[model samples]
Target chain A: MKQDPDKSRMNFPNRALKWLVILMVVFLVIEIPLLISHARHAYFKIDGWFAFYAILGFLACPALTFLARGLGVLVRRDESTFGNEDDKTLPEDLDEQLR
Target chain B: MNNFADFPPALILLLGALLVPFLKPSWRSVYVILLPLATLFYVLQLKTGTGSQFNLFTFTEEPLEFLRVDKLSKAFGIIFSLNAVAAFIYAFYYKKSTQHVAALFYIGGAIGTVFAGDLLTMYVFWESMAVSSTFVILARNTEQAKGAAFRYIMIHLVGGLLLLAGVILTIARQDGSIAFNGFDFETANHAGTWLILIGILVNCGAPPLSSWLPDSYPAASVTGGLILSAYTTKTAVYTLLRGYPGWEPLIWIGCAMAVYGVIYALMESDIRRILAYAIINQVGFMVCAAGVGTHDAISGATAAAFCHILYKSLLWMTTGVVLYRLGKSNLCDLGGLHRTMPVTTVFFIIGCLSMALPGTCGFTSKNIIIHAIEHEHLFWPWLLLEISAVGIFLAVAIRLPYFLFFGKDKGLTPQDAPSAMLGGMALLGFFCLFFGFAPGTLYDLLPHEIDYHPYSIAKVTIVLQWILATGITFIFLKKWLTPKPGISLDFDWFYRKGAVQFYRAADTTLNGANALAKRTFIDGFVKWTCNFFESGASRSTAWLMTPIWMLQGHNAEEIDSLQQSIFKRSKRGAFQIGITAFCAVILLGLLSIIFLLE
Candidate 1:
């Protein structure tokens, strides 16, 4: 069976994801030791630990995203929340006005 | 200073603006492109430590410096002019002369503010910026644009007033000296300094006022937004760097703005608004650096601001092209545009220059701030800033491009941006790479000499790991992360909805009260007076006439005719003249009193 070029192209995202994970693993292998061996000083001890920045980066995204999602429940409004009936692009009373 | 060197670069652009309206279209394009270049040349020629001074009315002791040439101002001056050239190139396809003029004045105002040596001079150019930039927003001429422009100007006017008050109070305290310089916390405790800081903070998009930026910038015209992205907040950062370095509170405030911008950006569906919020995020870094107040930190802030103007403007221009072609800026309405707008995607992805990605301008510039934080051992802020750095990549670098160009196809096939816009983007994109690889070119322009490295193995490795991790997290959460069509409220909610509702409520109540008052007091009084005159006069006349008629043994008709004849005979006589003169004297006396009070 021949593969469709479009179908192959569509698979790029999935393949790209797998490759990304592999790349991350390889980066961790190299980075973990470098972080441990690196001469670091800090105002706080925990920040100087190996993988501290890496862990922060990994956690910050989901934490901030979820927090923002929670905030959205409070702050989110309709698309036209700032606008009013007068701000409508199309007049609602067009028929009446025309008549 | 020689006359040529003393000639203000800002005036050159402003004077050139007056010529734009009268020129032929071809000449107008050439003129716009050349004006900024000419101003840049003049600015470059300005000698170090030399400035133009003006003594207003010969009463003040210190002459106001209209043109100040120093490492800091020159750095900002160069970038601002370069930004103008790129912005005008992108705007070449736009035909409206008024927009071009407004843009010119806005750029001129920014340059003026950069070069101003005194608070008074800064305030004048500050107001010019507020007024001209409002026109840039208003130039869009949409109803939404109109509303946003009004809000934008109102916020800036308040900021400008605060700044003016601060200037006056500071000068008063300083024996009438209006020099613009840095102040420590002790000096900052003064009402004037705090007011000045707040004023500058408002422009920095700090905290509550931060929403004004995301609210207004996205509402500008395609070209207008790009122009706006370059100058306003960056200029504020420059002012903060000039006047309030080492203020510790800005660190927390700036971090709040950073996180605040990211969270809102994540919640936003509109691509332009996302970019707007990202501006607040990026400027947050600069503000935090300024607050850190180290030599390295200030240099970092300057370099970051310089690079930020380019990359942020590039992002805006790319999104602007999308809005111009598709008539939509919402992420939900955009996807898989990379196939059609490959050039824009290529340029837009260059916004990673602002993401501190390796081999980009952001890496070299933003790292300096991080290095300063580490050097200063501000552990908590360092952690927060580092996290926000990742959030920047997630919000702008990864999510923005993925949804805008690579995600689910929206079945819309808009063509690439026009050649002029592409040309502008390409120029900025090249500089992003050029400055990334050769950061010394930027570092050489800094106000201080410092040694910094961005390409170390540990740094590069950590950055890569973080970015890769962020990417993985994004992929896992892709489905959940897709933007839905809605608005995420920000501090703008207070003014946009709360203030407007308050105004409406007040208007209704006041109008109703006015109507009630008119009915109860005014109408009643008028009715009573009319009735009293009509009935009382008639009754009194009848009573007198009846007695007169009975006493004189004459008819009422005869008495009435005799009265009418007497009134007609006295019409032009001394009695009428005397009464008119008396009334005129009283009216003149009242008018004099009113004029005297005024």
Candidate 2:
């Protein structure tokens, strides 16, 4: 049997991940020097202090994720909770409508 | 003078919509596409001044100017027409003729609202929009669509009534002119202007009622969602820009909506609902800009609204494609779609232009709003905007596609979207980059002249770094960030459940009381009266028959039959008399009470 060509080809996501890391490194490297030299028209000088947006961006995601999780608990319901009596249980003809 | 200039562009679309149902099936598609184009050509040919006029009624002395072609109206008119073209193209394959008719009337109403020269004209078109858009929702014909459409129209009906009340009050207070122009909140001495503002805010997806956007939009048909996304809130934004700019309270309200939208979107499982919340978040930015009311702020707000219409609709269309092919839009059910549907994935990535990435349409427009905020030095609002920006990236731009295309590979294989859809997406995709690479084309269409540059080394670098950092955060937290399958509650819960419960309780209590009254008073009284009449009649008959027997002049059988028939007639008459007396007594009581109260 011939060698599997699929195995020989590099996985697309893996290669993309590798390039993404490289791009991130390049961006961070460029960002650091620019942060040192940039003069921002900020209301407070501290707003322009090194890598402020980067830190804000870095922390906001996880903080929001957890907050959303907390919110999800208070607000979460079964998907069937919305709509009227007909929607609570899928209709017999729903599959036909979808097609 | 009823010259050619007297013809309103909206009339073109409206008249064409009336003709759609009569056309042959093959001709219907051609008719739909040509209508908007014809309206667009008419819009372009019009001059920059009020022309069309009609005598609305005797209530107002001066005739209403139905077409107002100022720079502001013109800008919105152009975008609304273009969006109609894109929407019709995307929905080219839809077989429901009713949907096309509703969409056309909806578009006409929006265009009319923008071009309206007086408050009366605006109110007329606003209600038209409400009715037509409800039909679009109802066209889906699902049970969910029916219920959601009812709720949606009920809310809009309230909004419309508020608008009408405001217009009437304002005209009564202000010399009966009914002019549509900016109101000075600083010197606003009348309640009419306030009522108008509240009405406009209702449509803007402002707080307390903002939940309607997410509650109803996802319940629409795939094509319906795309059309719905473009018109309603943006027209409200246009109205705000026209009438309530520089009102400081709007700035805070807008900021609240921006953050509130992203927080809820993060917890949503359905892809369409997430996008619905995103519309509110994006409109919040424009609302804030309108509140700022500076030259640059207004320009930025308008530009952002225009850009938003394109990108948001593109996002809706992409999700719609998924919904059409895979039969579901919940994140839990979709995975590894990119392997089979590469073109759709690429189109979706293009649709992420609203994330404000560099070299996308969003960068060119959204930065101006931030710049305006910074220039104004509104520290708290600016900081909140920055935080929300990252939230948008985390919740929508990064989260949506990652869950749909990447991760766990749920082994679903669906075909790519049809070429017609791809063609429609390609048209919008072209503009996203077209405006991105060259901002001048978009800038030239603005209501004001401005000198604002969107791309600079510092700005580009800052944006890139922030996105990358957000990316890194997601990478580390991806497992925990996977969307769970559930529904999130919203303000609509108060109306959807609380109000519904209150109505239920009230209905049960009143109905039970009604039944009790009928059983105890009406039925019992009728029964007792009948028994009393029967017993008295029998006793009298026995007494009379004893005397008649003594006379011995009549046959006993004949006498007995006559007596029985008389007794039966008397019983029937007694019931009728009792019912009549009861009704008459109640009516007299009610009349006496009214007289006493008066």
Candidate 3:
């Protein structure tokens, strides 16, 4: 069997990368509130900075999730990624010219 | 206002694109050529120096504004139309009519962009270009093209969405309607500005979000690759000049793209991809010029943009011609073609000069930008540009020809390029020479005064020395730079592999608990409801049916049977006891609910 890199198990280096992504997300989330505070100080002291921090906090989890996915060295097991592969749907007669 | 002014020529060409696909085979080629030509003449007519604005009702409540004909816009519109004609001529017999139609619409959308007087109109044309151009990539008819087109569309649509947000926010923060000539950035820090910046940067191939381009562009069909090279990013450079010039961050971003693209191009073996990365590097020069924002800087930026489209398209067209004739585009699979494909080789050499070879179109225009940076004393951008100059020689200028044509002969012979391809190349090659020799013509067209000359002895000497030193480096290290079989990963690894693992890990941690809890909770509730209904129905039926059975059996002879039934009641007492027990259990449940209510 060809050892597909996408499906291969993570070696130590791969594991380390996932951990790094997690840590970065954590660090970003923790500093976000403080960063918002600092930005307000530099400009005008505005209340919306708090809402901004909250919004970032809400987004951080998903961002980290996708970031980790982007860093992974495994192939997706799900078949849905290729869409409908069974039909071999060439573009009908119109499809001939497009192809 | 005249109807000529009301319908911009680009829009008319765009509307005409739909009909191109339906035309007869004989008419297709002529239609493709004439539409852009007529459209070009129409845009030339708009040169009377008039601007119009209109609001449109689609994504927003206000009518979308369209601005027409100005100096800054005319430069881009005229050249874009010219590139369309050249591309159509090159693609005449190569790609299908469908792709030709798509390319026309794509070019039209790009032309619409330069004439747009407002941000909203620019964005509409911006997205229209994105959607239309994507079909060019998808025309390759490979599984890879499907994924590539998807990613390509994803990035541009994201750019479009951000642009919409930026335009809206900027309008809300301002007191007057948009005038699209040049940006006045003091008022641009509105919500729309960030949206707009992100939108434009996405198209400009800025980092962290830049992988979609290299990931997809090389996968396009041969003729498709030539069409793919021109509009998208340059439109972004145009938009940036209109909306966000002088933002200091753009300087660093431009420098980053220049170096990053050069490094990646050095690692790629695919010729089209190398050319694609070269596009990023060349755009970097203009972007940095935009960052400087002086009259000289803007002129340099504008000139660099003009030269870039011609040279970049030339390079892609050269490669596309070679691939079309030879049937392969990867450098590893190509070699010794200079013997047979002399026309392509000659054109490729001329195209290389325009990419910053001394005394070519690039040297004339690029020196002004590099000099503008030096005159401004921006040390970092200047140093990076110098390093990138060396890197460009290794990555593209020398590397492209060396591996593709002069490499260890790969035992393949391809015929000479077709006349259409040759004609396209000859036009670009001629311009490369003409512009290099007489740069004043290009310089005079710029929006600012031309005070700088690129042919001065000292500057030419410096550039020549850099090229010499780099060529010497290449001669010594040529063995190390040879193409090898390997695929290096880029930032896209996060989405390709990283995202899957992240999802799997989350599923792994929760799957067992989620399944167990759900099964137990649902199954137990279902069993309890089934048993309660079964016992209650049995008890209720027995109580109602017993008396009815006795009455129905009570005929004259049934009287005797009824008396016997009365006598049998004592024996049936045990059966009644069982029925009574069931009824008591059901009544107790009802009484408990009643008691709680009370």
lDDT of each: 0.84, 0.83, 0.71
Error of 3 at A55 (Å): 51
Off by over 4 Å in 3: A1-99, B1-6, B55-65, B506-514, B535-598
TM, every model? 0.86, 0.86, 0.76
Question: Runs in model 2 with CA error above 4 Å?
Answer: A1-33, A83-98, B1-6, B533-598
lDDT accuracy of residue B591 in candidate 1: 100
- Which candidate's TM-score is highest? 2
For model 2, residues B1-598, the per-residue Cα lDDT tens digits are: 3334567789999988999998886788777888998888778777786678778587786678789888778888888898888878777777558888999999999999999988999989989999999998888778888888998999988988888889889988778888888888776547898888888888889988787788778888888889899899999999999998899988998898888888888889899999999988888898998888887888888888888888888888888888888778899999888998899888888878456888888888887888888889898888888788888878888888899877668888878877767877887888888888898988887778878987877777778777878887888778777888878988888998888798999989998999899898788988888777766776576568755765776577767775775577666654357866998999999999999999
Q: After superposition, how far is residue B472 of candidate 3 from its true place, in Å?
A: 1.3
A37-92: candidate 1 lDDT, tens digit per residue:
67443456876566656677679989878877889889888887876422335221
Output the worst ten-in-a-row residue range by lDDT, candidate 1 chain B: B566-575
> In candidate 2, which residue pairs clash?
none
Model 2 per-residue lDDT at A45:
62
> Residues B1-598, candidate 1, lDDT per residue (tens digit)?
2244486789989998998999988778778988998887888777778888887636556887898888889999999998898888887777668888999999999999999999889999989999999999888777877888998999999998898888888888888888888878676569898889889988889888888888888888888889998899999999999998899988898888888888888888898899888889989999999899889999999999989988888898898888878777899888999999998999999975456788999888888999999888897888888888888788888888999999999998888888989988887888888889999999988988878978776677667767877887787767767888888888888887899899999999999999999998889988998767645554454556566676887777877775554444444342357767998999999999999999
The positional error of residue B350 in candidate 3, measured at the CA in angstroms, is 0.7
TM-score of B-chain for each predicted structure, in order = 0.88, 0.89, 0.87
* lDDT of each residue in B1-598, candidate 3, tens digit only: 2233456767767788888767887678778878888877766666546766554454444444465666667777767877777877776675357687788888888888877867668877888899988988777667777778887898788788888887777766654455454556665555668778888888888887787778778767776777777888888888777666787778888998887777667766778878888888878877887888777888888888888888888888888876676556678788888888888888888888677766688888887887788777787787677666667655677878988878788887767777877877787788888888899888867777879878754455445545654554555456656665444466666765576787898798788778877688767767778766645444454445556767776455665564455445534442467767899999999999999999
True contacts kept of 3: 0.00
TM-score winner between candidates 1 and 2: 2
List, residue by residue over A1-99, the lDDT tens digit for candidate 2: 885778657576787788678756766685765766664445656567666777878778888788888888899898666544344543221223445
